[model samples]
Target: MAELKNRQWLLAARPAGMIKESDYRWNETAVPPLKDGEVLLRNLAFSFDPTQRGWMSMDTYVPAIPLGAVMRAGAVSQVVESKKSGFAPGDLIQGMAGWEDYTVTDGRGMLGLQKLPPGTDPLLALSLLGITGLTAYFGVLDIGLPATGETFVVSGAAGATGSVAGMLAK
Candidate 1:
């Protein structure tokens, strides 16, 4: 149909004490053509987490977000164009889409792009069914390994991951 303009928030500078609006710069650019094994996605939802601070400031499990690059964040997106197998137009997917209206990927990153089952809620897919849920699932089932009827204590039970961990423990 019409041409697409990709809106983006690029990392301008690393934070000093706390993050500020000036740390990022807004930009809009033309969506690039897809190459083989790549898929173009329109972001629908974004996941904001405390770990993103680390990603912006220092090198952690993943490298820090480079200046002049899109600020990193996980997102739920819909495929707009695909040169990759198993992904097609209109498919809903989740992965590291950063702070952008559009993203192009080859299903590779910290969490590779994954297709959402039909009718899945985008918000739920990015939250409880995404990294937060996966972290709770692994912690409670794999690491804690609490037996039935055993008391499971979850700190920060009001937070995202902890709340899910508490629920999964039940």
Candidate 2:
């Protein structure tokens, strides 16, 4: 196969309310050579969540992605090359790989590199079994703490977390 180029969507500016495509600047960068203990991942899909907007804000659980930085995102990707022990070519994994089509990692803290079982569905990995669902599960069960027969209120009832929260509430 031909050499793979890395394509990325960078945060161009902070938005006031909702985000638009113009808020991002697309650019291609050279994929760097692998270093010892590093693995190259080819991103397959990204999760669009409300927290992404929060990340665009001035403050969040993590520092906001800086302007000109690749927009922060969680992705499902396949290992394309590996210098790491547990990760090998063709292994599917989940992590915070950002908006780039490719990412390189040495499996450090919070990068949260997790290898999926063979034949595991990427859709499931990106959804019900992913952060979105886990967030909903915790937010509803732990944080919300609604008792049986208690009414549950979800503000963004149409969103991924909200929908899961709603169902878990019911």
The numbered model that scores best in TM-score is 1
Model 2 lDDT tens row, 103-130: 9888774548988888888978888889
TM agreement with the true structure for every prediction? 0.94, 0.88
The sequence of per-residue lDDT tens digits that candidate 1 reaches over residues 1-170 is: 46789899999999999999999999999888888999999998899998999999889999999999999888999999999999989999989987999898888879899899988898998789999999999999999888888999998789999999998899
The models' CA-based lDDT, in order, is 0.91, 0.86
Error of 1 at 134 (Å): 0.5
Candidate 2 stretches with Cα past 4 Å from truth are 1-3, 109-111
RMSD of each: 1.4, 2.0
Worst 10 residues of 1 by lDDT: 1-10
Q: Please give the TM-score that candidate 1 achieves against the real structure.
A: 0.94
Given candidate 1, what's the lDDT at residue 77? Answer: 93
